[model samples]
Target: MIEHRITSRSVGALGSSGVDMSFLLGPAVSSINTVRILAGGGLGEHPAETWQVFYVLSGLVEVTGSDDTHDAPRTIVLEPEQAVQWAPGEQRSSRALVDSLVVLIEATEQIPSARPL
Candidate 1:
């Protein structure tokens, strides 16, 4: 079994934007992670082929994205206790409006469909 304390875990670079993140659960276990973004920091935008979830733990953040049908991007501000899920094929990105803590969970899972003979 794997166990970790969020506060005890050290923060590391998330992406090119200089955001900090702690892996409460790494991708090896599952794509579950907790992230902290300092003011003006953000995760770069990307398109997802599968659904993903983000839960706001504290502070404020602005989520912006555009779907396949919409050429314009919509912005949503999330505060503590608020959560947002993005659909597959949607472009998404997040920025810390203030110092923020968020938990990210990727719903996609890769399980072997068949066993080798």
Candidate 2:
């Protein structure tokens, strides 16, 4: 078993403006992170290579994205307790509409088929 304690001071940068994210210790096949964003901060344009989920814990957020066949972008607003998911190859970005805390969960491409945890 693995155990970790995450506090506000322990989170790290996510390369996005106004956003800090920290990975929770566990899961060899996926990533679990806590993300904090200040108002007006956001993640820039990026392509999804694996399944990803975002759950809002507080405040408001705007998620924008486009699928492979769609040239137009779709935007969604998420308030506290709301969630969103992205599929592989989907282009997406997110911004904090207000100060917010979010949880990010995603599956890595190279997941181990057999492993003991």
Candidate 3:
């Protein structure tokens, strides 16, 4: 069985940008991952390579993105139990407002919407 300590231990994701990532599933058509970032830590803006969802597990974060719509950039604040999704080719970035844990899902399937953050 695959077992892991997603919160406290590294699951082989290389550390960078003041974030720690752990794998919960695959590196295939779909995958589940966790991102742990301290207050003020974050990922820089980059074009999404696949359908992606970032869900907050604890604390707070602000996600900024400019999607295929090509509209002006938008920022969404997320707290515990909140999330934001980005379509492939969208440019996005995120910053941790407080010590936070976030789950990242990358897939080709249609992800259902959760309570809007």
By lDDT, the best candidate is 3
- What are the runs in model 3 whose C-alpha is more than 4 Å off? 1-29, 68-70, 113-117
Clashes of each: 0, 0, 0
Q: Please list the C-alpha lDDT of all candidates, in the order they appear.
A: 0.64, 0.66, 0.69
Output candidate 3 Cα RMSD.
11.0
Who is ahead in TM-score, 1 or 2? 2
Winner by TM-score: 3
Q: Candidate 3 lDDT, tens digit per residue, 52-103?
A: 7787889999888875444588787788756667778878899999999998
Could you tell me the C-alpha RMSD of candidate 2 in Å? 11.8
Candidate 1 lDDT by residue in tens digits, 1-117: 001123223345453454554333224224768999999999989886565566688989888876444668877787875655666677788999899999876665321221111
lDDT value for model 3: 0.69
Instruction: Give residue 38's lDDT in candidate 2 (0 to 100).
Output: 96
Q: Per-residue lDDT tens digits of candidate 2, residues 13-104?
A: 56546555433323533777889999999999898867666668899999988744466987878887566566677778899989999987
Minimum summed lDDT over a 10-residue window in model 3 is located at 1-10
